[model samples]
Target chain A: MREFDLLAHVYRSNVDLPADVAIPPGDDMGAIRLGGQTLLVTVDQLADGVHVDLATASLEQVARKAVTRNLSDVAAMAARPVGAVVAVSLPRDFGDTRATELFDSMRRTAAAFDCPLVGGDIAMWDHPLLISVTVFAEPGEVEPVLRSGAQPGDGIYVTGRLGGSNETLPDHYTHHLDFMPRITLARELAGDAATRPSSMIDLSDGLARDLKHLCDAGNLDADLTIADLPLSDGAHQAARRTNEPAWQHALGDGEDYELLFTAPRSPRIETADVPITRIGTMRPCAGATPAILLHLPDGATCKLADLPSLGWEHHA
Target chain B: MREFDLLAHVYRSNVDLPADVAIPPGDDMGAIRLGGQTLLVTVDQLADGVHVDLATASLEQVARKAVTRNLSDVAAMAARPVGAVVAVSLPRDFGDTRATELFDSMRRTAAAFDCPLVGGDIAMWDHPLLISVTVFAEPGEVEPVLRSGAQPGDGIYVTGRLGGSNETLPDHYTHHLDFMPRITLARELAGDAATRPSSMIDLSDGLARDLKHLCDAGNLDADLTIADLPLSDGAHQAARRTNEPAWQHALGDGEDYELLFTAPRSPRIETADVPITRIGTMRPCAGATPAILLHLPDGATCKLADLPSLGWEHHA
Candidate 1:
């Protein structure tokens, strides 16, 4: 069975959603009322073989990736990070030298985001190295954004280039571990209530899959123009080497820790810090089968189901 | 490299503690300031083979153990439980039915503690099953009882019995996973300024090892009378079977999930809900060689270094 299927079953049947919980499972971050403030928390894991090739990747890269990936969820809700706690189980052969490096990297990366490493657990065992990071963040001046707020007329925008996260990495790295989490940009977008996003999510599981998440959450459909997809430099280079269109990689290549948000209109985004590309629009679902439609550069239209599932399948 | 040594290194050098963090790593739970409240959080994990024999243990037992272990930490701090989030990685052979049982057990246990399961992550892989639980709690009206507050003249008290956690279980089950987390009892003691505990910790790694934690955190020594140790019924039976002193098992067997605290004096403990035993007293350190000293029933005193280290050694 798929990982999401198991998680969805657990979320639907098992969890007892208390009244204090503002956001539930299946969101970027689950939030609860903490005294007078709202606290948003999320936990994510990166396994040695599943998320990265531990042989080639450094302990620092692995540590940074684990922290940054969780921070991406913090940014998705436009929440101000408080701090984080980490839990790691290292393989038997992993030495203390690498462990020291891992913790150092985690400290540095957390400090960079103004999120300190307050607590953690570490153990050595026979299993592959696994890192689980749980982050705590506070809602910004405005209410935190949810993925279920998108409307029929909202414009779909992305913060940075998509795809190529798997392409430009050096031999020692699996993906773009150095990429920023877009925390500041999301906060800026969230500061203004009129221009704030109706719904938002981080692109960790490809454009198509993540778009479907947004659509399903909002009960709407996504209509996108393939030509408008923001192709990263690494995406173009990989497309040339692999003899494929850059847009295909842009759509399917996951690990892009960029922001995909739906706004009422192009909300006066400046192209200084990060590029904001309007690639699509939200529409009312017309049929049961096709929830996501893409207009091709060759004057053709295709449903999301028709496209080859080239991105990473978590279970596959 | 022992597990404690690795953890001590991380606690000593790795974490970057900020002003907002009241309690750092190496405690039952770390505390941070959120708005006007102090939030105490902790995350702990249990692996299949390392913690339980998955071949004989049911998935429900595994799930319950993971959540209960974390709630015990909350009880140590006398914190009000807000909620908990769980992360699990399942082995390839684990079936969907078993997964359902695991989640349902986790939910029921969390709710019993008034800590609902708000979110979680589940994955399937080739490794043995691993479960990590992160719990969030807030301090009561009074400040949380810290491990560093033990005074030289304080009396050491323990709630419930200890030891023999390794015995009395069926071939498939673990030390009773149904034990309650002393949340209400700790909160009652914390609410009163006069009768509150000077320092506290939940018993997980045996009385000897965890007592060392309290001593090290407070920079003091503990003098315990062996005869006064509250031996569990399971401990008595197991000691009879193993031809060992019941007190030996009482002090060395881990996973008791009991509360051990140091108060100024025997503070009018109500022994109705749970048994309270005044085991010993805290004292000033006399020497550097032995931090924990045990007075035997025969009136002979010995240092902890002279003991055989019968407690659990985590990865060992």
Candidate 2:
């Protein structure tokens, strides 16, 4: 709700947009069709204390997180990363050596994803470090996915395990900082028009929150099966430490960076590593209150809207 | 030297670059040749207290400056602005009203340049306001000029007046916050191969510094006649207040946002408004000690390296 509201308010414009804009400002990546080619671009910013704690994160980790997160947005749109440009405003006291380290790390990570670091801007300022990476991508052979295509009877699926990405302590190594973006799996899922996802989203913010976004965009409702949701080992460990259910950690704690999507029928792809699991089904909109139902393995139903920190205030 | 040195160090990488990259990192913008079309991308950042004094300038002025500065880079390469994505990290105390105002201003400015604000990322942090704007552009009819293309015997020229853009007091109004980028003028100058500049650069860092960039990139030296350099009215005012020569201000005080370039022969285009003046001549590099010769109106010559702030240490 917060992201949607902010986006609507900030992107409200009076200018007439060009016809080449295939996708507008509020999507995961904006697409422009020019010269028989489609270019997809998305930007993500990582700030100290907000996205990463400099006390625990090395400049390399911070740089990696910044590049990977933007790549994740590209994956959500089922696009191939082409290039990236970064802009950094670093505290004046954050020495030149660390600055070089950060840029080198970003270049290395971007190359690992086949998205080379093309160019960037760096400035020394009296502020905590903030790095904004903008990635330019090209759409797949098939039309890229959007969040507004899910329909009733569509089966919902997610790639890999989720949760405790944030609750995983820095000392224990957090997936929130180092998890791989799902670009490869996205291509595998959306490679063919016949088997492509109806709608897709990356789990940057928790499953309940991101799934809620897809449902809101499509004006649909969803019923998720708690028994089918894959939980990470970090989620189990976190639940034990907090005296909460592991499933709760899997659904609430964010930054898994996995792919969540929907299709008419789940495609059992021959992927080697990442497991594709069907965990829910899209349903017709519940009209005025469009609810997200969470069916527990113990046969109890709870509203995802009722969960605490399902990412913003429910119904606000 | 500072910008170039930082660029070299920050852009050093160990990955194999794709051959499609026409212009690599360290230039004003990186160009990618994809699908028979060229895409030019450049990024810039504006920070609080560093680029603008919030005490004197409104958020609208800051946003305008941010968008126009990057547009200036596109102008330097004779590229047409197409789209832009901005990322902002605002302080926690900066209320929602201010955030909306800032975004709206950015959108408006971007639209004025025909570069629509296509997407962005926003965050709240405990830092001075920092905005990163990345622009996507396409080349003009001819090849976009590069700084390294300046050739010996080319005539040096500039679009519009320069200097005192920084010294102009905020109350009296400074051109630094409101200057129009030279995108249109660049098109007029580089519209044809016969008349186009051999090399080009935007004077964001003053004539002495930015012109030095063109010369350094091309392995050339230059000689400027003092009376031929067009001085802004603000430059004269600053010189009167500081007791320095007005030409000193024209040669040193930065942020003019004007275009300085070189061609084999000056193209006296039939254009109105912004005046184009031939101010100097490029020469073969001096090798061991390349010098920028300044011919004063008093029939005396001085090395540009001897000026107080020719940007960075003279011989360091």
Residue A30 CA displacement from its true place in model 1, Å = 0.4
Model 2: lDDT of residue B134: 98
Per-residue lDDT tens digits for candidate 2, residues B119-188, read 8888777778888999999984757889888888999999988778866564567888989999987987
Model 1 residue B285 CA deviation in Å: 1.7
Worst 10 residues of 2 chain A by lDDT: A307-316
Give the per-residue lDDT digits (tens) of candidate 1, residues A1-316.
Answer: 6666776776786445777887877799888888788888998888888777677667788889989999999999999888888888888788888887787788788888988777777766798988888899998586788888999989999987887786644443334676789888898898887669999999888888888999999989999999999998778877888788899888887888899999996876574378999999999988873298999999899988888766556432
DockQ of each: 0.57, 0.54
List the lowest-lDDT window of 10 residues for candidate 2 chain B: B307-316
Please, what is the whole-model Cα lDDT of each candidate in the order they appear? 0.82, 0.83
Number of clashes recorded per candidate? 0, 0
B272-312: candidate 1 lDDT, tens digit per residue: 47888899889997786339888999999998778876744
Docking class of 2: medium
